[model samples]
Target: MLTNVAVLALDGGHAFELGVFCEIFGMDRSDDGLPPYDFALVSATGTLVSTRHGFRVEATHGLDRLEAADLIGVPASDPDVPQPPQLYEALRAAVARGARVLSICSGAFVLGEAGLLDGRRCTTHWRYAAELARRYPRTRVEPDHLYVDEDPVITGAGTAAGIDTCLHLVRKLQGSAVANDIARRMVTSPHRQGSQTQYVRRPDPGRRSGSLTPVLAWLDAHLHQPLTVDQMSRRAHMSPRTFARRFQQEVGTTPLQWLTGQRILLAQQYLENSEEPVTAIAVRTGFGSAETLRHHFFRRLGTTPHAYRRAFRADPAPPGR
Candidate 1:
């Protein structure tokens, strides 16, 4: 259903953010058994658009292209520039018809101009977060997140964070396997949790001292086992309370939440790449039973295990086979 994709070309756009959309959605991967999108770059006014880096790119289509787009990407542009009335109306109309729009970095300002960010939770580059909040007072701006997904409108933070936001839409619309395969091709993480904090300047407390890398690696290898905060604390040679505090500090989440996330990720892999039954996958991922797995899967992913497998399973055989 998300096959048609278009990117809006504006003057003084960031080339890297535009390229991120082109790379993720414009590439053809049908030979690799992945779906290829009907992708286009469209200009709101003319064909030749200038970039913030003092370069120019040409768009073959105009605003008419946006009408058919299931997902419209708005790359970073001059936030202070006034958007065309036609472009703003087209964006509102597209969203009105159930089409989704995504913005990268300062592109969130364009969405705000279109009145799409009103009363929605969004984010932009940290440097511009306060301005975005001040301009769109009704919207909740979370500057610390790598991205924010308010369903039909997703906003990414900074430059490279656009990659995370785009991959997340793929995982949401298609499935994890498709998103993961695309990410592997692009040499990036498929699904970085949206709650993960942005990189900030912090003093290093010496290399490899009091690090939790070994513990994390061990947990990765033992995802099939029932992991507990108490057990993990003992393995790390710390009290349970201390371990919980450290996990929140280092991982941005509590130990059990992180472990549940890991198990859910493992279950997603099995559902996509294997023919294992739901019960088998639940047990394999340490969910104890299929019912528990379904509860967590739906709670975390908003889809049941069977439904997710049907959408994402990679089997290539013909239906009758």
Candidate 2:
């Protein structure tokens, strides 16, 4: 029942993904009608930690917590410092004792370092996927997909995918309803991606002083409305032609495609978080119709909203299962 989940935090760990696990399990999700998880942050030292970003975090638990965990989470961390030997031994021992190990972003390196990923399938952030593969030649690393679960050991693709992976685990254990309930409370999606087609239009950003930060923020806030290159151009004070050319060049994606992805992301969030039904989520996310929402959600996430939610909720039986 996921009675205990231990998240390992070390020097230079990214707080956001660490916070992701806390959001899903560490917090009181029961207020949202979800199950409660016993969650704690553990470290090699059982003391306060400083991230690569300069924030300080204290974890009172030590490596002993790994022995009692149903799941062990490894969030993003700096690849510079290697994981301690004792920590690696603790991880190996935990998995040997049947505890599931999860890694987010560059945290894949931690699993690799522990020899847990040898001859197994895994993944990490796209930016460091090549390095992960190069470093762990015995492991097969998938560069796409939001997350890959090798049953006992799972790895998320990047920062946001960490949330998706955590929710996916909840879906696997509790049922779709519970996962959706927690996701809604967190304001995130139940399912984000499938088969890597949605990620095909990945655009590399331009490194000039003119950034798309403002435009991206605007798009995120106004995803419910119809957005065009011309409209976005006007908002950014650039001509339509210039904006289109530069957006494609800088963002490594078309404005339209990015907007569609954002809309899907929003729809996914609503589907997981709210019980208002697919039609309602469609309208709220600007999909216009249930049919449209169905098309995109299935195409992007490889499952329908109903099916996805059902698998992760209180219902133990999946469609085929």
Candidate 3:
């Protein structure tokens, strides 16, 4: 039922993060048979909000707009700056009334200030994760995720991941068909599970040797085959010990961890787009059995494979144009 949307335009907000909210919720897409949201940009500080990118945006609405919103989007702003007390009060009121609040990147800090993130699991951009955790010790901070949906408060990782976070709320509240159609209009992937890693490792420019790109590309093609660190190490021309170290440094995760994530992603595609039984999909995605698939699905995605399929299976397209 999440039809009404309001985004907070805080002073010094990051332009791209604010744009993510506007792009996902503000546009009129009823022509595509999608539900249109009553959307507005509410200036949390003042009518003229200045972005960190050296531009000012005039928000026609103010904090009063948030009163009627089903979803309130808090885009990234200066985490160090203290938000107005009234802004935080409005947020708590909205959540208390059963509305949802979503934050992109450092916007999670604002939620932390409002006491919304207290005792809740949340995430933010990797670069700011440590600070967020340090600032709000009551909340458990998961640094690696693209987003975390702890019901009333949703937190997204860095810039592009904001799109994933917003679409997820839409999918959860509406349906995957609607989320996917919006994503198609936006020219982006329809669904990236919140459990997916942020992939924050940056390549060391000083060391140009022994990139694992070839092995990773090979692994993608051979996911159906049982894979082992030793086997992959041989393909990368390194010993198991060296390969494992390099993979962790370059990929921000162990090879086995990365492999499991990739397999789960492949299984998700099968469940959504195909009518194959769970056992078949498990084998196809290298989970080997439906039981194993369900275990990983629940652990990583917080749902059973059958439930995921029921929620996300694509709807049949109408015959006539």
Candidate 4:
């Protein structure tokens, strides 16, 4: 039912967020047995819009194109700048007519201006979460969530999270088959596990050639080894307590937590790009067994390794030399 898609562009937009919408919805994927969306970029202010990075984009369509759209997207824009009256009214009209609306990052602020975020659970980039909450007190802003789907209004957290939000909408409307196909074409994960909390950047640990750099590098190289705090401390020439404290100081997480995250990332690469069995991948990633791998996978990603492979497995490489 979500056939026609339109992205509303305003001045001072983030080009990357706009491109996320364009890449996911603007392409024709019928050759892959996927639905082709009738997509357009409609200028909310005028035909020419200035990007935040000092570039200009000429949107071929105007606000009139929004009337025919079944799903509307608002990419990241200047949150402090007030939205145009006509733009706000147009957004309200679309929602009132039963057309679903989505916002990526700061675009949620636009929805708030349009009065669509009141009493709604939403999210934005973690950096702007405080301002979004302060400006829209009635809205519950879950900063740690990658995306929040409150039915007619969907909000994505940050840049890459916008891709997750768009894929989710596709999965919801069509099915996993279509969404997975599109994700494969885009060369991204079909379904990413975990919240944005894991991605929030921590304060700089100060020293460039810190004491933990070598230890961290070693851990990355030897994820398959049975590593423990005692072993790590021995390598770093520190006591277990000192090593734990140093690890947290430099990495923003404990030794075990950092190792688990690394293993999971490696497992994800294998799931998407290789034909290796789940058990084999488990052993390679230091999970010892498929059961342990599945436990961690479910806890972190909300999906099994096999299911993730099935959804994200890439097309076989062309026969080569």
- The candidate that wins on TM-score is 4
Error of 3 at 144 (Å): 1.3
The ten-residue window of minimal lDDT in model 2 covers 199-208
lDDT, candidate 1, 274-318, per-residue tens:
888889998899998999998987776656878777766788346
Model 3 misses residue 7 by how many Å?
A: 0.4
CA error at residue 316 for candidate 4, angstroms: 24
lDDT of each: 0.86, 0.82, 0.88, 0.88
The model with the greater TM-score, 2 or 4, is 4
Q: TM-scores across all candidates? A: 0.63, 0.64, 0.65, 0.66
| Candidate 1 weakest lDDT stretch, 10 residues | 196-205
Which sequence of candidate numbers ranks them by TM-score, best first?
A: 4, 3, 2, 1
**Cα lDDT of model 4 by residue, 20-69, tens digit:** 99999999988888899999989867778889999898888988888899
Off by over 4 Å in 2: 195-321
* Candidate 3 or 2, higher lDDT: 3
lDDT of 3: 0.88
Greater-TM-score candidate between 3 and 4: 4
Model 2 lDDT tens row, 205-284: 33223577777876777878877888999998999888889898876788888787778777756655556678887888
Q: What is the lDDT of residue 20 in candidate 1?
A: 97
Better of 2 and 3 by TM-score: 3
- Candidate 3 ranges with C-alpha deviation above 4 Å: 193-198, 202-321
- The digit string of per-residue lDDT tens for model 3 on 1-321 reads 699999999999999999999999999999999999999999867789889989999999988898899999999999999999999999999999989999999999999999999999999988899899999999999987888999999999988889999999999999999999999999998876434341434233344335888788788889899999999999999999999999999978999998988888888788788888999999999989999989887787666788777667786335562
- Of the two candidates 1 and 3, the one with more favorable TM-score, higher being better, is 3
